[model samples]
Target: MKQTEAQWQSTLRFAVGVTAAFVLCEFLKWLPSFLAAALVAALLGNLPIRPPAKVAIGLLVTISVSALGAFLLSVWFRGMPFVMFGLLAVWMLLAFHKMLGGGSPLPPLLMLICLATIPVITLTAPAYADVLPIALVRGMVVALAIIYLVWLPWPAVQPPKPKPLPPPRETSTLRLALLATAVILPLMLVFLLFGLADVLPVMIASLMIVANFDPRAGGRQALALIVANFGGGMCGMLLYIALSTTPSLWFLAGLLFFATLAFGARISAGGPTAPVYVIACNAMLIIFGSSLGDSAGSFSLWVTRVFQFTVAGTFAVGMMELAWHPPVRLLPLRAGRSSGSSPGKT
Candidate 1:
């Protein structure tokens, strides 16, 4: 596919960023959380976010949300399934609503807020009460700072933005949110009750598809979104294993840089397959790399992470298909009625 000048420039900046920011972080041994890279990728990948100030403000708000979520989780959320479910439902609405307007640099922010609020990390964190807020605030600041350095030299200009998506029907947003809550709440309850350490990916995949998808795309598209996340997650797991025991942090960082560059190039080129690859790489980088600088993850834990993600992914995709009713069909359906139609086709 022919790439745009903007595409080329965006990819170049990202590739350079992968090397510079990640390598420097490794060398300095800073920001020991996956949230760091995930946050950066959210900013770097959103090429439409021109004039760095918008990105800055969005990130600052995201940081605040993350800290607050963490603080709340630390203080409460134990043995309170109904309360937790209610809170998560609200979070899902806030985090996923931007989809009605197309993309937002804020999905990652929402993802962070959800993940931070969940008991997954808080239950296990050491002095988590004290460290959770500090760690999150510090991590967001450092990640944003690194990203800022990477973008500093680029001459900023407000690029011509795409027209905002026509407001999605209120019914559509409400139904989608309800469907997501249905899919996610049960799975989250199960994971939480059972003491799972890695429920992040599952919730991430569920809400992400909701937040990421265009309303016109329908249930088949929902399935594809989940598949991409699963594929990316598997690749991410492999990378996690590779970096798990590497003796040299610099070597690990170099490998990460090259990997990031490849993923960023795909994103820049807007290749059909780029999203899966890029998402896979980012998922792995955040999961494994975050564990590296602070906590010690084990073989059993890694395996559980993969297994539980599979269970959660299947649940999310399956339930969403069911929730959409008429079951995502092969032949065309009525036009302009619901999310299932393929606009303009007879």
Candidate 2:
């Protein structure tokens, strides 16, 4: 397929926008710098806002909830297994409740809480109170960065959007809880029971799979995530080896720009498959960040990350196959309707 002009424009905008945001994050001396860079990308990618007001609402809600939930989960449910299960149940119900509103920012924020609870609470629960302040501040950075990036003159264009599904359901709610549980529960249990530390990659991979699932598309999305993440991880690994000899902030930043442009170009040329770059670029960045200063350690981590993403993607796909296998009854208007109909038109 020939690359359309819109797609080419989108590539340039994404390349420019993401690289610029990442470069600016390098200068946030007050915060943990790499974490800020990585998360700035994250918050921007997932941001579900179109207007300025909702941007503020989404940002505030995501940060406040994640930061607060992190602290609370750590203190309240750290070592207790039954208590943890209860917490997941409650969160699942809360997600179901909020998702009923469909257009509210709270549902997205709420799921982020589910994912954030693992990283924030799991790593810092008992002995790491000092980190919460950093995380909270980091949340602020992500919030502000998202808003700034959204309004950038060269804005990243989203690919043609998939049809939006309707409001929540028992199946959707259960699937939400299922995906979160698959990542969070096992990691928590492992941490509580035996104490392991490398769950981050797995969590990220599982998240990529779960979040990208579209009932309308079925198994193909999961397969694409698994492949793209693996390929991008290898790409990042190769980049890491080449760059580590003379590493500097400027060099890393420049590489990020060019690498992003490459995949963004592919999206332009390759059609809808372009957005798979999210999984790919995310893997590259995460691997790049992990590989920053140590050659031996980076090599070891490089292999592990690829394997973990494979495992996580497969696990999520299997879980969804069992839990939410779909010929989902989309809303009346959304079903068998042309693209002209507005989503959520009841």
Candidate 3:
């Protein structure tokens, strides 16, 4: 009974917090407004307790430094495509290695995001390159503020934290890094080659999928990810349609509150599918927040965005399968069969 009560408390907290963050961002017309709400949802859903001040500070510092470094590097290497891509690949590999090797995930994740985003933005829209880093910093600042404020009123019941997983062996870590690079680089190249800033979310989604993927879980988790993306897209579409009918910030907030409550229930259920709901909520925020900012909010644009996310999820899943079960695995399998057939000869 106590556990059930705690679960409901957490659910209400998540719903209220996410809704408040989204409404505030929309009202203020913050650039990259979705980021604040998404971050709030992530923190509230994943962490049972509010993060310490020191950890929050460290994260902000990491975000700022990584974004600045990536932006500067992109600017310096704007004229050299091959050199830029080579360096970016190296950076990505190192980040993935650190993440897989039990290092703090935020630094590497921020580094990877900055590395992917800054270079592409620099290449395609040089004028907007300077703005990207600043916007990221500001979004993070807002997210942090929202996190603290919401936590004050709706503190979660402090469950015992789970033990952190042991790091993979060095060889395994390296292999995982290579796999991540393999999954990301091709998609990054496509965006860079075409300068497709409009569909930037696709690359971001691919990166997130790669970061969260587990080889042991395999295709089941992969399918869940794809389904989550579509589910989120559908939610975004529904929210947009509802907003169209009323077209008020308060109404938007109410819609978000109710919608988040539904998502929050799933998230608070604490099962395998919890992570899927989290992803779906973040996806909904990204799509809804960005579209809300646009003046036109065209139906075709929403369709295109949904299609892009689906394609990106599919591509990432395929790459992961290929990576996890490489051609080399077949040689071992064949050798095992041959040895089994001639067991007496051995």
The best candidate by lDDT is 3
Per-residue lDDT value at 98 in model 2: 53
**Reference-based TM-score, model 2:** 0.72
Residue 32, candidate 2: how far off, in angstroms?
6.6
Tens-place lDDT digits, model 2, residues 102-205 = 55433354354444335443553546554544554564556465546545654445455565566445446555555545554564455445454444445554
Q: List the residue pairs that clash in candidate 3.
A: none
lDDT score for residue 47 of model 1: 49
Which sections of candidate 2 miss by over 4 Å? 1-9, 24-51, 96-125, 129-133, 136-143, 146-150, 155-183, 265-275, 293-298, 322-346
Error of 1 at 187 (Å): 3.3
lDDT for every model?
0.58, 0.57, 0.78
Instruction: Quote model 1's TM-score.
Output: 0.74
Error of 3 at 64 (Å): 0.3
Rank the candidate models, highest lDDT first.
Answer: 3, 1, 2
User: TM-score: which is higher, 2 or 3?
Assistant: 3
Q: Least lDDT summed over 10 consecutive residues: which range in candidate 1?
A: 155-164
Q: After superposition, how far is residue 289 of candidate 1 from its true place, in Å?
A: 2.2
TM, every model: 0.74, 0.72, 0.88
lDDT of 1 at 174: 64
On lDDT, the stronger of 1 and 2 is 1
> Candidate 1 on 87-197: residue-level lDDT in tens?
766765555554443456464545544453345556544344455456556655666676666666643433454554565454476676566656656765675557655
Residue 207's C-alpha lDDT in candidate 2? 57
Candidate 3 lDDT, 20-130, residue by residue in tens: 878887788776677778767766776667779997898799889988988888888878878888888998999999977774566677678777777788888887888
